[model samples]
Target: MSNPADPFVEELRAITGAAHVLTDDASTARYVGDWRRNYPGAARAVVRPASTEEVSRVVALCATWGVPVVPQGGNTGLVGGSTPDASSREVVLSLDRMTRVRRVDPLDNSMTLEAGCTVLAAQEAAAAAGRLFPLSLASEGSATVGGVVSTNAGGEQVLRYGNTRDLTLGIEVVLADGRVLDASGALRKDNTGYDLKQLFIGGEGTLGIVTAATFKLHARPDKVVTGWVAVRDPQAAVELLARLGDAVGERVTAFELIGREALAQVLAHGTPGMRDPLAGEHAWAVLFDVSETSALLDPTPAVEDALAGAMEQGLVLDAVLAASGQQAHALWALREHVPEAQRLDGPSIKHDISVAVSRIPEFIAEAGAALEGLLPGIRVVCFGHVGDGNLHYNQSRPPGMSDAAFRAREEAVHDVVHAITARMQGSISAEHGIGRLKQEAFLQYKQPVALELMARIKHALDPENTFNPGRVLPLPVATPRPSSL
Candidate 1:
């Protein structure tokens, strides 16, 4: 392993400061792995750049040495893309030190922020300007704006505001050759040339390192109405979404579907004060919210009426409308902690997938049946943004099942779920980028022409693969050389 005294380390220290270049094993350990701790990588050092210029210099230095640069943000990525590989042949480039909100134009409803800014910080900046940065996620507290933009994060508000891609107006990235692309001005419409900024948006730091971004903001909603509605099944949840959209139109901000198993996990393992909002044990539930521009206009009545109509049509089994802001917050807490509760439960396989909004029910039903037949008694903890057709269809070990045994079948479990997803014209990865986790599935499901185009773009931008190698793109299979011995 390279030490602090290595010339390479000295070169990196020259680019950034000595304090910014982490070389000690204890200090660099956290940067070598992912948040989930599922993917463990080894890096000689973790370089933290304080600005775009420093990031450019760091990338340029790495390129000069042919060292792969894995650009990481808040390190909250689930797909293991942010972490380096086990080879210890790479340098982890962290942008955590470059969290500068360069500008915020409330009049333009836009904010230009460095990649290191936490999602929450960006949201607060928008709020301070009397605007809204709607791209939200459970990891917003830790997930950085650059990471979200790279993954093209889609949260509850995606039903209304769309993904990070839609919210991003421009970006400033450091190409593999250490060239700076300063396209960080918010432009509502620019048709003169190719949309170059977008290439690095969801590029997952493969083509280049995203140093900063300019995001489009929105007017802050004056009022929000939240509801917890019990539905018969996924189909009912889909129908209810349609009904709610018809009544409230674009006022529908979020529509999340929670399975009974998912809810039970939360109620069982969640913190105190978290309780079931609705009465009776239903198979499925939906957590939805409607927002209005004027505080005087109460969206509660409209939501209640929609639920009532849905009940009459058998779309809604029962419902609880949040009467106060506290109640609404409590309801959202339940939905957000589903994954945490599952983690407390045990080891399991997780799949972040998406199909058409209309085909979600069918996909869920088919995928569930397929998985059960493959591994009977497997507890399915399925839930997600139903309005956007994305579902975190995760699985847990059955009661008293050996953890070792359950984990041994992860590949088989994923195969069944992914096969069904492919058959239904669904994506193996929805909001989450095809990081190391789903690279194989991505290759399997993505069209040949599409894959070719992606490879072409990667080669065109980073021909030497100086940036995140063996990530979104599948690693080439190794063929044994003719027996030389």
Candidate 2:
């Protein structure tokens, strides 16, 4: 156990106040575990600093002590990116204390928020200002600004508003050795040099700690139309989205593809009174939303026309549109509760992958077949933002298989899935990032030159490997040696 009176822990207490530095097992339990419970960790102490300056100071002190620092926001990450490792020598720098909305500019359509501001809270703030922050995620209530920006998160709205990287205008980072880099501003265009903030946007805290950020906001939708449509297959769902985009342009804000198996799990284990939107059993379904800024213009008719066209082409099997706001929320509930349902069900090996939008159907078909061939009766729960070609392709164990026996085959399962992903020229990791779970696969599949460049950047930005080591990259990048006389 880490002693509170230890010199380093005492220094952490002095920096963030004794109450903010958590060292006890009870107080630090939540910070050490990843959201999925796949990577439970131990931390020497979780220090919650309120301001950017305090973060900088804490980081600098850790550098002086040669201690590892795991920069954490809400700890709601999937791949063990934000949680510490089992070694209790590392200090978890928690940003949840720094929840402050510094400013909201209506004219600029920008909002500056401290690192700990929750995604849901940010959206609420934007709504209060009569604007919209379009980055939406299943974990939005607990996922923090710093975590999203660090992971460069992509959620349901990527079809319209883009990823966190696209929405981010500027950022403020605390670099190794405690240097503060203030890049947070509302500049839409600056053609000076390379965009440095891009490095930290998806760096996963391997490069630096993101303390604050400025994000672009859009006009709040006056009308939102949500629909649950059963499709013939993945190909049909893909075609439907393309046709919808062509018909309504950017008004199609969110698009989600759900498999029948996934929906079954939700209905079985999700919230009570949760009923399927469509009565008939369909192999595949899509839940999507269309929003309009002008209340006078209804997107419903256009949506109806698009679905009608799809039906004419034998693409859509069945469909239902939410008639009221309550119905829309209920429709959304089915899509959002999938992860919880999976959790309640049992252990499953999950993969976050992406291929070309046109190749989504083929990838699913091939990958699903490949898994079934390898392990007979392996239930596949596949779904995601097909509009962006990303899917949560997961595998539940075959019936009568022990969890231990199933988990033991994880490497084989990943090998089959990742090989197919590579064959399709798709990413092994789409939005979840190359955290500890995928580091070996990343090193295996990533281009050798790209790995070299990543190593060089890590060495350049964090020579001592002070920030979140062994999270993204496969191994610790050795500091370069100096030439001697």
Best by lDDT: 2
The TM-score, computed over Cα atoms with residue i paired to residue i, of candidate 1 is 0.96
* Per-model TM against the reference: 0.96, 0.97
Q: Model 1, range 1-485, lDDT digits (tens) per residue?
A: 84347889899999898999997789998899887789998997899989888988888888899899999999999998999888888899999999889999988889999999999999999999999999889989999988988888899899999999999999998999999998998889999889998898889989888888999999899898898988988999998899899888999999999999999999999999889997788899999889998867877777888888889988888988888899999999999999899999889799999889999999888888888898889999999999999999999997778999999999999999998888888889988888898888898889977777787788889888888998998654222233322
Question: lDDT per residue, candidate 2, 1-485, as tens digits?
Answer: 95346899899888989999998899999999988888988998999999999999999999999999999998888888888888898999999999999999999999999999999999999999999999999899999999999999999999999999999999999999899999999999999999999999999999999999999999999999899999999999999998999888999998899999999999999888999898888999999999999978988888999999999999998999999999999988898898889888899999999999999999988988889898888989998999999999998889999999899988999999999999999999999998898999999999977777788889999999999999888555875444331
Q: Where's the lowest-lDDT run of ten residues in candidate 1?
A: 476-485
RMSD of 1: 3.9
lDDT of 1 at 112: 95
**Model 1 residue pairs with clashes:** none
Candidate 1: residue 228 Cα off by (Å): 0.3
RMSD of each: 3.9, 2.3
